[model samples]
Target: MKNLFLFLTLLVLSVGVNAQQNQIQQDSTSREKLDEVLVKAVRVDADSPITHSNVDKEELAKRNLGQDMPILLNYLPSVVTTSDAGAGIGYTGIRVRGTDATRVNVTINGIPYNDPESQGTFWVNLGDFASSTESLQLQRGVGTSTNGSGAFGASLNLLTDAFSKEAFAEISNSFGSFNTRKHTVKISTGLLNDHFEISGRFSKIDSDGYVDRAFTDLKSYFLQGIYKDGNTLIKALTFGNKEYTYQSWFGLTAEQLQQDRRQNPYTYDNETDNYWQDHYQLHWNQRLDNNWSTNIGLNYTKGKGYFEQFKEDESAAGFANLIEDDSDVIVRRWLDNDFYVINMNTTYKKNAVEIISGLSYSVYTGDHYGEVIWGSDLAPNTNIRDRYYEGDATKNDFSVFSKATFKLSEAITGFVDIQGRFVSYKTNGINSDLVSFITDAEFSFFNPKVGLTYQANQNNSFYTSYARANREPNRDDFKNGVTEHEILNDIELGWRHNTNKVALSTNLYYMFYQNQLVLTGGLDDVGSPLRATSGKSYRLGIEADASIQFCNSFSTSTNVAVSSNKNKEFKASIDGALVNLGDTNISFSPDLIIGNALNFFPAENLQLSLLSKYVGEQYMGNVDSEFSKLDSYFVNDLNVNYEIKPKKLFKSIMLSALVNNIFNKEYVSNGYYYTYDDTWSDANAVTTIEGAGYYPQATTNFLVGATLRF
Candidate 1:
């Protein structure tokens, strides 16, 4: 308690130190404005009263070699990332502010990246995307109104690389533990004819994951063209990836971990998941006059994937018009989806007021089906292509939003935002057991936001904001009989201080949820989570992060978050009886998260850094039972890089290395649990039994790489 008080005191003192300095110059227009068309509709201004973080290309290149995107963002506040391969290569997941990936709104150049059916981002589909990204922004709560699904937890928007004026070529390669390797080639045909430019990149990554038989083979390409003339700018981009990975969804239990941590239950050599995704986008930007601008974008995405598994002792009743005699079998499930979108925005900036408005329409069509590969049925006439179950889903999303910011005084500014959304969803499907189902639903929502920012001085400012967010459930929720959508009322108060020697940001937030969909830690047939709605829940937290530059050669950055997440009047069905379990902790919501990075530069071309992370204890179920608890853990890593500019042949040469888990800490980042009744007990009473599964992390690992640029 005393430490918290002292920390708050220091924060206030830091802001007050510059009270005698000059008052900051107020600008009607944002200084950090981007020139790209796709980002015009979703990005927030530098002076906007919102909590956000921006990562540029230079920072991304420091860690962009082999790991997935989530691994690159592990150092952010209130973020927790895990990899199923026990290394940072394949099948990784991230949670922000205790909310899972499904709740995070993700976009690529203002186009929705989350699956329309599942509402989740699959980073594997865009392999090595960081290599082609120009900048990205992460908004922590329900921020400014944006495209795609609702922002229940956080929103991430990425802008691809822009045109270069000078021709360039580069080659990069990395090899590390688990026989992992990455190869990349990039080239640019800088400003041809002084009006057009073309650039492209190709990447191939392969890894033998830490988990037994878990491997990934991925290939990707990115191509783009830019045309700029006078007041008009046009951009065309095409990017995609093809990936194949060995199945490792089934996790280990405590007993199995004690025996062999690397054991995989399935012995089949062909068990794997294969997928491919492609995206095409075009944008046009036009400037009408000195105070007006407009942008329009059209995008299309095609995705298809299938995961194959081995089933043992399957029942014959599950198949349609066939008998398998309860023999071993192999089966596969497939998904093919297409999405189309059109987005437009107009901006007017005059005097001390700025107004921006946008409209978007999107459509999605997805097909889901399953096939049986091999079985004991001796019927040679059966067609192998016949699907036992087939389903189709179609959805349309339409939304309009407007935002206005006006100066209330020389040092105060006010912001207002409003958005309206309409959705129509329809699905008809046959379950694997041949059971049929259909659903047709429509929903409407209106969200509003208001905020005020007070600029204290040239180096300090304070802001407060209130926002309302509503989110509709995904396809799985509909299949599980959930009819109503969720709502959140969020309030945030923050302060920021920046100077030549230090930078600091602090926020206090309260989030109230109504019918929030919470994780149940149970897996569905396709290995994804099955979620349930909690009647009432709330989260309150404090977040603080800062960077200090002690001298020319030493610097450090750190962030810490503390929060309490709880369910009110929780109840569960146990042993065929409803048990009232009063107020309890929300599952998978940790109370504390911390991250730190310390850097040292001994020479102009050499740098070293140490990274550390800590996560508090978490529960797998809402009841807070001892059997469902996961202990807290801390982990650290060391990274070093050296670069040299040659006078003769190559332009620049660079070498980098990373050592993860330097102390070899053993910990579990994620897990699930289930309880069932054992009716074989004495008399007529029923006994309960529980089972749990955990995904343990790898110990010590290393990766090294080299790059040559000309």
Candidate 2:
């Protein structure tokens, strides 16, 4: 604690010394005036018309740094985060409104990025990938039809760095709470007299995770080579790698967790894991006519890695694990993926009937390898091979969509959007154990959506939309033992407001699920998890977000979400009172989640800022019972910078530093009891005998860094 205090004191002193010196000539607060800074972050893709929100490179840097993409996205109105590693920076998750990430579609350059088999995005697997993202867009609801992955919740599209003109270089170092440190380096070389450009970036991040053994050592790089000229552009990109200390999915035993509170809370040990992914992309953009543009994209990803750990028991002879001695269960896996997509669209600005149309096609080929290193269930402790289960898969996605804007009148403008999609999925090459019976299946899906938005005033707009989303069962959802299906229908209504300074947006969504996967309170061999299909489930919620620009050098942003989501939950088996699913609130669903940031610039050469973050109470299961609730927590962050002007023969420079979690606070992001039944005994009724019970958050951390650019 003393060390932490001293670090903080030094940070404050540094900021005070380098802080910006105000310019007295400017009449800012004294005179009433407003300045405008128009944002050019929006992308000009072909024929796609949609309501989109974007964060530019500058905006991304202003938020937190590192691989926790969801943390930076928390300000989006209809978003919430989940974490097992206490601090939101390490191991965390985000849900769009009420739908989990599986329903949240993600794309890069119009190509699918989700794991073809799992459909779940484990961002932790990407390491310091955020450092490479040049710009990103988040489209809420069924706003527009894009390529690949089902967009039930929302869609996020990202574009990496394009080519830059002139030679430049940058270096940034930052440290914050949780012993988190990030080091970055970037260089760009403009060649061929502005006809060609090349750039690359390298980043490394290390942290003693919030959870014991939950540490993360992430390293990655981005390299881009581009060719551009009037009417034609072509580019190629390669990048990705991530490694983390394993916190495993296993939760804490209620007794052990309560007694220790600081330890891993799990029985298993020696589990540090590594994950890596490499992507190669080729893209071409061509302008064929005055109002026509087209883009063709091709990409491939090679993903291979695993999280290894020690197991408690050897034989699965029965549910009783006490019969055997503790053992080591090494779970290994590797995956290779390739994708292709092509899209074309045209636009016409003539008259009130503005027309936009487009067509897109996407395909994916994915393969996986799974093996068990040490398991008594196998013959005489012999290492397991293909017999354990591994396989290959191929899937195709195609879509056609169009939108037309019509100025119905001067007070209100309206637009109509429609889209159709066809999806076919298949997997094979291994028996029921490796490829599994689940892999022998073949399925198809047709998704359609439509929507409209009307402006009531300059600051207010109302919109409504409906969409049908179908998901072929994922690899886990297809287990041979007992697997079912997953499909969803979503309808949304919302309002949006924007002005010169402050902006507010709210959404109310209703979702229906068929053959929804519900937790059977089961565990996989590696402490992952298992779920079975139940009849139905739904999530309804209200979310709001706002941004206020108080003045040129000052701004604030806030976001909050509240909702109830669940399987066709039941209050009583006998009474069978229809559970609202929206009543008790979904497991892991928090009643309130909020984040706020303030930026203050005291002088032309200096800037200072303070940030506050909060997430409300939440539960661990469908019942929303007493044992499943997670307590709320809050934290603070401070940032400061000073510009150094050089004289005569020198260049200019800037120094910056950040201090996070002013004071260490003990907390947990997620936890669950092993059993949910009515057994109330001491010997057999331990709260967390099996399931992962708790994941810890980060403690007090201090880091000071600087940046230099030329």
Candidate 3:
């Protein structure tokens, strides 16, 4: 730790000496006149008084190997990442400001990516997506209005690679610990006859995870075509994912972890998850005039998947027609869903004011069913086609929003945004409990936001904003009859300073929630989530980040967040009784998070970096018991990259290596806890026993890669 501080000090001194000679420059002449159709609907304009960060392709390429998107964004402010495979490869998840994935809104271009029912972004379904992305923006809190679900916590918008003016081809491959391997191929036709361009990429990745049987096999592809004219641009694209991974959801208990953290609880050979997803999108942007611009986008997605699990000593009566034979069973749960969306945005800009309006309509249809594929010898007549339950769900959503920005003065700006949304959801057939039922609901919401930005000077600025957002319950919430609209009132105050060598930003936010759906670590047989409202909750935090350019070849970036999350008068169900836990800390919310990166270029073509992260302790249960806490951990990584200009054989060649968790620290990043009644222990009474499972992280791991471009 002392050495790290010393290095930071020297770097800062070096940066001061070179400040007058170095300045980040922007080329306005090369900027696009019209934004991509998919992103325009949700993105914020300049001087909008919103806090956001943009990540470009160059930042992604340094570590673009087999890891998922969440792992790549792990160093961002207020972000916590976890992986079920014990490594950053398959089934990874992220939480922003302690808010889980279900609350984070994700979009590709401008199209929604979260599952309508689960409200979760499955990055595995878009294998190697980082390879095709050109840029991404992350907005924190109840940010600007967007399509599909609301941004209750944060929003992630991704833009695919743009058309290249020059033709190019590239090949990349990587191999690493845990038998991990990745291969990718990409090409672009550049501009054809000065009017059209085509680009495509194919990728495959495989890994034997740190945990036993946590294997993953993934394949994906992306293809896009673009047509451009003087003031109009049109694009069409398709992407898909195919994945098969063994079940690693069942985590470890304290005793089991002590024996071996990598132990697998279940010994079934066929326990695995298989899935595939495909997406098609079309976008058009037109510059009607100097003051008017419009964008339109249409998207369709198809997804199907299933996970198989073995039940021990299951009740035979749960099967459709099986008798009570007191035998074990193996079952599979399947999901097939279809989603359609249409989004449009129009912007009018004149003088110092800009007005932008957007409209979006989306529909989703999903089928959920379970089948008993195998049975114990006592019941030998089982077949693969016998189903236990079948259910269907459909949702229709529509929204319209308008935002106006006005320049109040030479250094001050005012903004206003209003949105109206309508949602209708219905479900029929059997639920997780095998109970046949039918339910339907509708909701209407109006959200408003207002803010002001004060550009005190060229190098300093200050901003503040207030916003309100409402969200409807998801499928899981409906299954348990907690279908109430969740509401949030958010406030933000921030300041930013920028110069030739240093940039700094600090933001303070307060978010109040009504009837917030909080996770209880409970899951259905199929691993679908189950949540309950906490009645009242709030989160208050301070976020600060800074970056310094030491010289042409050296720089450093760091971010830190401190927060307090709490539930008012929390209550829990313990052995069929309501237990009040007064003013308890919210589960899974850490009070402190810190991230740092130190980069240096020892030579003109060689670069090296060190990344560090620290997360504070968090509780897994609302009661905040010591037994349910995940201890704080600090981890670091080392990265190196070298580039070569081989004029004879290839246009350029690059090599990269990443050593993760260099100290090999043993830690648990995530966990789940639940308490159940043990009536058998005392026939006349019930004993409440608490059970917990921990997801241990990998120690030291490495990945080495090479890229060839021509």
Candidate 4:
């Protein structure tokens, strides 16, 4: 805490010393263009042959009272979101086009953000990041070559807040249901002397989740310094978060849900997850001339955390050096990791053609271990903080890609993209189960893409694209005795129309897979979803979104997605024998999803919105058993925003309100299923029994907030 205070003091002093310096006059448009060059390699223009969506800061602020990024993006064309705490505060997840988060590539300023081993994006680590974001783009269905592991499902990239041109300060506070509260402070030494700028933000959030004992406490910070000149830009930034959240991944069983949906099975007070992560980034961009530009990015991340658990009557053999059986124990699992990345890209434009090429390299190392904090009975030589199991892992990844777009004729354009990725991973040591686990693997893949866009008229355009992607299995797959890589072939066709007051887009996509790692509807001991290899699978879907303005005071926007996701000749073991389930529905893949938003502007500064969502029933297991089906649900929310520009004390004041699940619907958005052999049912034959668990969502809730700008 002292170090933080000192740092802030130094920043303030620097800003004060430079406040009286003469400012240099420069074109704001040129500075904005240079800032955008940082992410141009990973993003596409509006007319590109890609299916994507854009969300700006203004749109995100409406519901940004206090929620994770996944919850903020829930209304996209093909998106589904869930939370372990039954609210959007802790342990949140997202799936796109019926694919899990592991397959979604996430990048911040062209640098990869997914965990190297798990290939998962944990939004909880960066609490309230939306506050510092300028904009984000979501490209669905292998839209382009990116800097991450692989975009088997989709790719998302975010641009941080652009430097302000003038000095400003802001404070925001909010209170919501479930004892939720958020506080934030932001400041900017905008455009110091017209060549430098300093900006920072501090935020803290707390919530008592809907489920019993599922509480969250989070603190986060973002700071950046920038230097800008005619065609040169340099930036240095750091962001991090510290969080403590109670465990809630143990979903309720059928009987438990029937009795009390909010009940948590574990009663231990200290069963919680605690983690801290910090990231440092540096970027340099330069425009050599009107036709050439380049960007370079470097990043380093440090993370360490642990989850504590209380075990009852554990076997002596399972824990090393335990001398007694049937003894209670409390343990903490720890992970310490460091990640480094370097990205370089260049863009060229001349006449009717444009080209972009980039290369990325990253290295990662992690240590996994467990320590016993307390036990009912300890051996003579045992002591607290002694590790019972330990492991180490290292990974390296490198990739290069080039993409080009050129006009083929007066009304037609052509696009081509190609990439090659190489990876190597190695691990050594004892696993959590007290077993020897060792692995060494290497992979190399080549991906190619092509597309065409036809501009038929002033208000209509059509496009089609085909892309291929290859993905390496995660660390869990290696532990489960699976090693094969997965492949995907995606095809997209779309049409878009735009006018002064109306906009519409429709997309048709088909994705074919080989050796796909499909979800098994089961979770490991630590709550990671389990997956298995399916020989062949496919997803065929159509997505449409539209917006219309009836008048200046009223407008509406709606989106819908219909899909058919299936696994061909799915096989499962039953009664000690393998059985083929022909043409089964893929687990966790809903057939239909719909979202709508109606906005009303009764006055210039007052706005009201009504939002609704509907999701179709989905199967939890590939076998499509009656017991594995999850029911469909429909939910709605209400939002209101009002602004006041005072003439005296402050610049502007904004008030916002949100009412979630207005109808108080009782619904389950996510769950898990598992099966086991029960030999006791019959002495002569084996019997397969199935069981399931559900994570119930929150009922009616409301939040109100106020922001003051000066």
Among these predictions, the greatest lDDT belongs to: 4
Q: Candidate 2's error at 198, in angstroms?
A: 0.5
Stretches of candidate 3 exceeding 4 Å from the true structure: 1-37, 377-383, 683-686
The predicted structure with the larger TM-score, 2 or 3, is 3
Clashing pairs in 3: 38-110
Model 3 TM: 0.94
Better of 1 and 2 by TM-score: 1
RMSD of each: 7.6, 12.8, 9.4, 8.0
- Across 459-542, the per-residue lDDT of candidate 1 in tens digits comes to 999999999999888998988989899999999999999999899999999999999999887777776877899899998899
**Which window of ten consecutive residues has the lowest lDDT sum in model 4?**
20-29
Winner on TM-score between 3 and 4 is 4
Candidate 3 structure lDDT: 0.85
Candidate 3 lDDT over residue span 182-276, tens digit each: 99999999999988999999999999999988998999999999998877889999999999998887789999999999887879998999999
TM-scores of the candidates are 0.94, 0.80, 0.94, 0.95
Worst 10 residues of 1 by lDDT: 14-23
Query: Could you give candidate 2's per-residue lDDT for residues 1-710 as a string of tens digits?
Result: 33334433443443333223222232222221100000011132212234346787756665445537887676566566656665555566777655567667777666667776667677776555676777788876544556666676678877676566677787878776567788888888875676788888888888776556666777878888888776567888888765565664665666657786656745455465656778787777664433334455667777766655555555533212212344435555555566566655443333344444555566777766555655644445344542345567877766655555557677445655455555666777653233344345544454555556677776788876677676666666765344444677777777888889988777787777787654443455554445556567777777677788999888888777676676664442212233334334555556666777777888897878776667677666555556667788786767676777767432446566656566676667656543433346555543432234666655665556666666
Worst 10 residues of 2 by lDDT: 32-41
Ranked candidates (lDDT, high to low)? 4, 3, 1, 2
Candidate 1 — which residues are off by over 4 angstroms?
1-34, 378-381
How many clashing residue pairs, candidate 1?
0
Model 1 global lDDT (CA atoms, 0 to 1): 0.84
